[model samples]
Structure formats: C-alpha cells, structure tokens
Target: MLIRDLPYADPGVPDVRSGRHFLLWLGRRQLRGQAKSLAWGTLHMASVASIPIAVGLAVQAVVDRSGGGLALAGALLALLGLGATVGDTMLHRTAVTNWITAAARVQQLLARRTAELGATLTQRVAAGEVVAVSTGDIEKIGWCVESVSRFSAALVVALSVCVGLVVYEPELGLLVAAGLLLLIAVVLPLLPRATRRADLQREKAGRATELAADTVAGLRVLRGIGGEELFLRRYRSASQEVRQAAVRTARMWALIEAVQVALPGLLLIAVVWHGTGLAMDGRITVGELTTVYGAVTFLLFPLRLVQEFAMAYSFSRPSAARAARVLGLRRSGDGAGVGDGAGGGEARSLENPAEGDLHDPAGGLLAPAGRLTAVVCGDPDEAGRLAARLGGHDPSAEEDPAEEEGERPDARERALPSVLLGGVPLDAVPLEKARAAVLVQDKDPVLLSGTLRELLDVPGSGRVSANEALAAAQCADVLDALAQGTPGLNGDPLEARITERGRSLSGGQRQRLALARSLVTDPPVLVLDEPTSAVDSHTEARIAGALRRVRAGRTTVVLASSPLLLDCADQVVLLQDGRVTAAGTHRGLLRDDPHYRAVVTRETDDELAEGTTHA
Candidate 1:
C-alpha cells in the first residue's frame, strides 16, 4: 500500500489476538513493499561488502607490479562504488515507503474502530491512550516494520562476509566469528531490561497524556470551581513522573549503545593484533592481513543494524499491544443479530413500524410513541445508564457471563433486559438499523469545529432543513452571538466558524447549537439527556416549547428533572432508585407525588424569581 491510497481504502481485518500476532499481520499485509525493500537492501549491502575485497585485490596487484591486474581492480572498485550509490538511494526510498504505508494501515484501523464505537469508545478506553496509540505507537510500529527487511539483508551480508574471510584466512575469520557471537550473547540479556524500562516509560507517558486531556476538557469547569491550581499541580506531577521514567529508559538504552560500541572496537583490535602476529610469522601476507582488518571493520555496520532492529522491536511491542487492545474492541452485537421488521432487511427507511413505544423492561418505564415523555431519575448516573439502554446500548447485555461470575446472580439476570421498540427487542436488530431508529443526545453534546452549515450536515435524509432545525432550537440569539464575534460573517451565522468544542461560544450557545445539529438529523426517536441544562430558565422554557412543536408527531424522550422541560412534556415519569414511582402530567405529579415535587422543585423559589427577573 502507498501513502496516497490511504484514508479511503479498507485497512482489512486485523489479527488482534496478541501484539506479536498483530505485528506479523501487518508485515503480511505489506508483502510487496517488504519485498522491494529487501531486494534494495541486499544490493546495497552486497556493494558495501565488495569494496574491501576489491581493495585487497588492488593492494596485491600493486605489490606484484601487475599493471593489468591493477587496472581490473580499479574498474571493479569504481563499479562497486556506483552500485552502492544506486542501491543506497533505492533502499532508502523503499524503506521510507514501507514505514509510511505501515503507519497508514494502523491509522486506518484505529479510525475505523473509533467510528464503530463512537461516543462509547472513551467510556472503554482512555482518551490519552488513544492519542498515544494513534501518534507515538504507530511510529514505533512502523519503525519495526521498516527495519525488518534491512535487518535481514544485513544478516545475510554479515554471514557471507564471515564465510569469505574464513576461506581467505581461517584463524582470523574464526576469531572474528567468535567475537560476533560474544557480542550477541552479552547484548541479548540486556534487551529484556531495556524492554522493561520502555514499558514503564510508556505507561507513565499514557497516564500523563490522559491527565492532560482530562484537564483540558474540563478547563472551564476547573476555573469555575477555583480548582485549576489543584489540577495544574496534579498534571505537573504527572509530567515529572513521565520525565523520570523517560530518563531511566534512556539510561538503559545508553548502556546498550556503550556495549555496542565498546565490544565492536575490542573485536576489531583483537582481529588486527592476531593478523599482525600471523603476518610476522609469514603465515599470512600483508595483503591478506589488510583484507581481514577491513572485513572486520566493515562488519560493524551490519552488527549495528542488528542492534537497531532489536531496539525497534522492543519499542514497538508495547505500542502494538495498545493498538491491538483498541482494534479488538467489537461493538456489543455488531453484525451478529437480525434486524427488526422496521428499517431492517431490504427496507432502508428509518421510519418506525406501527408507531411503536420504547419499553425499558428493567426500569419498567415506557415512552409512548408520538408524544413528549420526560423521565426524572434521582441518580444522574443511573439515569444516563437507563437512557443508553433506551437507545439500544445496554452495557450489561454485552458482558460475558462466564467472565463476570463475581456479579450477583440477580443483577446478572437483570442486566440483559432488552429495551424493546414496537414489541421487538432492540438488541435483536442490527446495530446500524437500531441506531437509525433512535438518536440519543447526551447531557454534554460535543460541537465539532466547523461552520454552522457543516455542523448541521448530519447523516440522514434531508427531511429537516438547517434553517428549520435552527429555528426549532431557538438559535436566533446564538447566530447573533456568532455574528457579533466573527467579522465578514455579516450576520450569516451559517458561514461563521465555531472554535473547537464551541469553546469560543457561551455554554447556552453551545447547547443550542448541539440541539440544532441533533434536530437536523430528524430521527424517528430522539432521546435527549439534559439538553437545556446550560441555558437560562427563560431560554430553557423557549427551547422546551420549540422542541415540542418541532417533534410534534415523533417519539421524544427527555431524561431531565428541569421544571420548564418537564412542564412541556405531555407525560412525566418520576423514577426513584431506577424504578418508575409515578406517571402523570407535570401538574398532577407535583400535587400527588411529594418525592417527584421535591426532585423537580429543587430549584429554589429565589432561583425562580431570579429567572423571572432575567427574562
């Protein structure tokens, strides 16, 4: 694979059984590039090996005073030089190609996994680990991939040189071979130490990265709570830990480098010293002695390649393991189930079948179709979990019973309760089909950085226009805010650029924009969790009314306790300890259910008065 073919091509299914298996799979995928790299690398090293032999022959010829032989030797040397230049250039090109293509393939796999898991990925994996895998991990994996062919070529050249030297002079050749073996034996044990240090460093770095990402994501909240210094100190400590680990890892590597350099130098000196003794005794000629010295010196290059290959592999193993962890994550039941009668099979429409109600068997809460229903749960976390289940995402349903034996039997039994739509189990349907039928907007919706038009250009039929969605979201003030901030927008809010996560905009503005984006998708079932939490009471009231009108005939489930939003729902269900305690109109619930009233009326009379004054 080439770099240009990337991002669009399928990255193929990976064998993610283990990190080693994944690395091997990557190598198999890029056989063609690997082959080219190997061929060029062999040629390059062969040219290098020929140089010493040519020089040895030239010295012999000059000593014998043979002009013709000298001329032949010079010609051979020139040819070797030319071949080395060409081979070196092509080798570099192919090696780089291998590196780039391998990295691209890994990146594509990561991107696909991220898309498949969507918002749930962060729930399963750390944001920093993902970032590290996509960045540093990939580079290390590519380095190992690119080093393989070169290492193979170097090994072959080194072996051939050893054989040739033995044929020319046995004693010197044997000594050199023994020295090479000694070097390998000494370095082999140190590799495990280096690898351990690398793993430690990577672990520290991943933690630091996770902390930084969390700190940045919650920077606004930290500032509001006057906790920036606390987090800053925590991050600083994490950074220091990373630095210390890196230093320890580097020290180990430096020791290995010292061994690589010192051992090779000692070997060279031993070969030369032995060769000099042989020459003095007239057992070997000066020309032959020169040949042995030059061969051993040249052998250092290939020995270094061996060292590099080992280092690259050590660094890449942990990275590949991280990558494998991500790639191994499959959606709860992706491609494993049949679809529901509605929007499944040959049917492509996203419309609900028979205007079905959404039923949560575990919570015993039912959201009737074609109406605005509100659910208020005492525990926000439980509410979010229930909301996810309503949207066909039950984490318990995806767990393995055999692995989770420690869980209570009753809890395990209750865990797999499937949310049904139109009387059909949601999990029985294919994931894409189920997702198309229901849209869940979380409490904190992310607004991607883009123009308003781009942000609202979500997948689905264009049933709702951007303007209509924006109006339904009560985004006139949001557009006005954008127009005021951005020059050349000229009051064209759709053309204005939003900063990353809408940080440049106010909290209410971001919330409204997110709501507009969700509205544009026009799904049959819209599940909103605290959609108006950031807005003022008056704006929340306006949004509640507008949302009802916009989703008049569709099934809309709002998981919130806000009085304004609940008052707008056609039916309000109060949930206490994950079970429905009361179901009625908002006014009826307030009058009859004291628990419901206390939960909904937590916003004090003073806050209500302030809201009224602001309005």
Candidate 2:
C-alpha cells in the first residue's frame, strides 16, 4: 500500500513495534521514487564495483613489473578513473531527485491535512509539533529517501569485492572478512542509543519552539502587563534545556563518528599485516597478495556507506513517528456515515438559544434566506466555538461512525450552539462547501499583506463586485484611505497596500476592512463575531445599521452583546449559562431581561470609565 494510505490505515494495534515500522512507513512512500532511481543506482554500483577489480589487476601488474603488464595496468587504471568519476556524478544526481520528490509529496500531504482540519487542528495538536513535522521532520524523511539506494548499492558492491578477493587469495580474504565483521558488530550496538538520544533532542526542540511561539503571539500582552521580562526568562530557560539536550545528543553521535573512523582504520591495518605475512610465507605470490590488499582497500569505502545508512536511519526515526502522530489525529465530532443531500432553502430549525428552547444537539437548521439573527453568549471562548461550528470548520461526516457515536456533545457545544444552514448539517459539511455557504468573520481576522483590491478578492462561486461589497460593509472611508494609490480607469478604490494583518491601519480601519472582505464573499450565511467590537460607538452604530441594510434578505448571525448591533437585529437570541434564556426584539429583551441590560449597560459603563480615564 501507498505511504499516504498507511497513515489512514487502522493503527488498531498498540505501537510496541520496533522503530523498523517507521522505516517501513517511509519506505512505502519512497518505493516508487526509489524504483525510478534504482536503475541508475545499479549502473552506478556496477561502475563502482569495476573500480576495485581494476585496481586489483593494476596492483598485480605492478608486482609483476613487465612491459606488457605495465601497459595493461595503465589501461586498467585509466578505465577505473573514468568509472569512478561517472559513477559518482550519476549517483549524486539520482539521489538528489529521490530526496526532492519524497519531500514534496510529504509536504503536499501535510498541506492537504491542514486544509482538512482547518481551525480545529490547533485544538487537537500542539502548534510546535506541527511545525516540527513540516520543517525538520520533512528534511529528515527526504534524507532517508536520498540515502536508501546508495546504501543498498554499496552493500552489494562491498560484498562483491570481498568475494573477488576470496577467489584471488583465500587466506588474506578470510582475514579481511573477519575484520569487516568486527567493524559491523561494534557499530551496530550504537544504533539504539544514538536513536534514543536523537528522539529526546527532537522532543525538547519542539517544546522550545512551542514556548517561543507562545511568546511571540502574546508579545503585545506581555509588554502591556510588564511581564515581558518574565516571558523572556522562561524562553531563555527553555532554550537552555534544548541546548543541553542537543549537547547530549551530539556526544552520542560523536562516539559513533569516532567508531566510524577508528574501526575502519584498524581493519585496514589488520588486513595489510595478515596479507604481508601470507606473502612472506610463500603461501601467496606477492602479486596475488597485492591484489588482495587493493580489493580490501577498495571495500572499505562501501563499508562506510553502510555505517552512514545506519546513522541516517537512527536520526530519521523520531521525525517519522512525530509525523505519524500528526496524521493519526482524527476530529472528535466527525460523523460515521456519508451525508447525501443537496444544499439550498431554509436552514434546518436549530435550537434557538435565545428563545429558551435548548434545541437538541443532534438537530440543526438550514439557514433561512435574508434575515438578521443575534447570538448571545457570556463567554468569548464559547462564542468562538459556536462560530467555528457554524462555519463548518470542524470535520467530515465520512469519518468513523463508532468514533462519532462514542462521544457526547460537551458543554462548550451546548453553551455556544451552532447556527446551521439548510438541511445539511453545518458541522458535518466539508470546509470548502461550508465556507462558500457561510463565512465567519472572526473578532481578530488576519488581513494578509496585499493591495486593498487584491485582499478583497474572497474565494467564492458567485460574482460579487468589490466596490458594492465595500459599500455594503460601510467602508467608504477605507476606499478613501486607499485613494492615496495611483488612479485607475473605472475608478478602482482598492489599490491601498495593506501591511501584514493590516497593522498599518488603526483598530477601527482594520475592522471595517475585514468586514468589507467578508462582505465580498457575500455568502448566504454570514456569522460576524463581534465585528464592531474595536470601533467607536458612532462607527459601531453606523456599521450595525449598514450591515442590516446590506444583508437585508440574507441570513446573518451576529455574536455580540453590543446594544447597537443587537438593536439592529431582526430577532435576538440571549444565551445564559449554556442555554437559551430569552429571545425577542432588542427592545423587548431590554424591557424583559435583566441579564441583557446588565451586559449591554455594563459595556456602556466601561466606555464611560475609559472616557473619564482619558480626561
């Protein structure tokens, strides 16, 4: 089976298997590429094998020291030189191809998996592990692919040289073979220890990456709270731990390297000593002994290849296991069976969280056409979770049925409750389909680096003009800001260069820009998670009114506690604790619900305090 298929296979059994399984996983992936390169590798090996035979013949000729022998030796040496040069060149080229292709495939698989998991991936796996899998682990896997054929070809060539020597002079041949075996036995024991050290080193490095990532993400907050020094100290400590683990790892590898050099040199010494004694004993001719010596010397190179293969495998094992773990992750809510349904029309009637009807978790509504809806949640995390669910950024319905049935909906799901679209469950629909039908503009949406026009190009099935979308989003000011760009025909207002995540823009400008981008998609269902949270009250009020007007007939869910946004909603849903506490118009909620007043009025109080502080 394919390596890609192996990851999806039932790892039904425990992972007590030796590290060989990891190699098998990588080998399965490398099989096709290796097969393509194997022919060139075989030819290269043939050329390499010829070198030792030619050298032995030349040595025999030199010992004979006749005119004809000298002439033949010259030809042999010339042929050996040509073979070595050609073989080395071909070997390098083929090996590099094998490396690049294997790495590309792994990268593609990883990218595909990330797209499949979407936002839910971070919840399932640590960010550092993912980084390790994509970068360092991928390079190691590539090295394994590039090294495989060379190792095999070298082994065969080395064995061939040994056999030729045995035929030329058995006594010396036997002595050299013994030395080679001793080298193998000594180095083989180091593999396990070296691999364990490598694994620990990689794990510590991953933790350090995680700590650094956390620090970078919260740098603003850390600086704000005067905890920058504390986080810096923590990061330094993490880095030190990684440094110590690396040093230990290097020590083990250094021992292996010492053996690689020393054992081979010792073997070469023993072979020469034993061969000289045979020559002196008259049991072997000087010419024959010389041939034996040349063969043993040539054979040492391939022996080193074997040692390298062992080292490479030892280093790559941990990376492969980490990659395996990442691929093994399955979403918690993926459904067991395939969902067969065409999308359109009113969304399934979901549990109205604001209507005091805690709708069944199993049920969902296909969203209706053109209506403003409000989602209320006390906890921000709960609101975000609900937003993710509604956007279909979760998992597929085709995942294992038993896995889906085994787990119950947690409090987070019940508390934040998804707003569905159509008969098809939003959570079960694939990301591509779900995203087209519904878009969730997160509280802090990332505005990638690009010109304003380029950034406004949202992925969608329908044609929506950028200007109309921006106008609908009440972003005329953003267009004016971008007017600083060179004028274009038809008067394009989207030429403004947005810095990474739009950091160049103020908080309000960024929010309006993000909202404008979301509006461009014009998805049938738009879920805005506190879109106006960062804007001033006046801009927030204007945006709220514009959004309702622009999305007049479209299904829209706004998750907010803002009085302005709530007042503009056609219907309001208030969630308390984890259930729907009340549902009605914004004014009705203000009159009937104390919790609604407390939240919205408290926000107003905070605004007044901010004004006082400024004064």
TM-score of each: 0.88, 0.80
Give the residue spans of candidate 1 off by over 4 A. Answer: 336-354, 360-365, 392-432, 574-615
Colliding residue pairs in candidate 1: none
Write down the lDDT of every candidate, Cα atoms only. Answer: 0.83, 0.67
Per-residue lDDT over 211-320 for candidate 1, one digit per residue giving the tens place of the 0 to 100 score: 98888999988999999999999999999999998899889889988998999899999988888899899998777888788898889899889889988998898888
lDDT of 2: 0.67
- Over 1-615, each residue of candidate 2 has an lDDT whose tens digit, in order, gives 233443433322212133346456556756766665565565666665665555656666777777687777678767766766776786787688767766666676677667766665665567777887899888987787688888888877778777876776777777777877887788778878887887788778878887887677567668779999998898899889889988987898788778877877787787778777877887776666666666666676676677677767767777766665555443333432223333223222322111122121432322345778887787887677666666665422222322321232342342323334544444554445555666778777778888887887767534457777677667777667666543562565566677676655667788888898887787777789889888888878888888887776677889998888999988888776546677888899777666676666665666656744654
Backbone atom clashes (below 3 Å) for every candidate? 0, 18
Relative to the true structure, candidate 1 reaches a TM of 0.88
- Candidate 2: Cα lDDT at 193: 86
* Candidate 2 C-alpha error for residue 511, in Å: 2.3
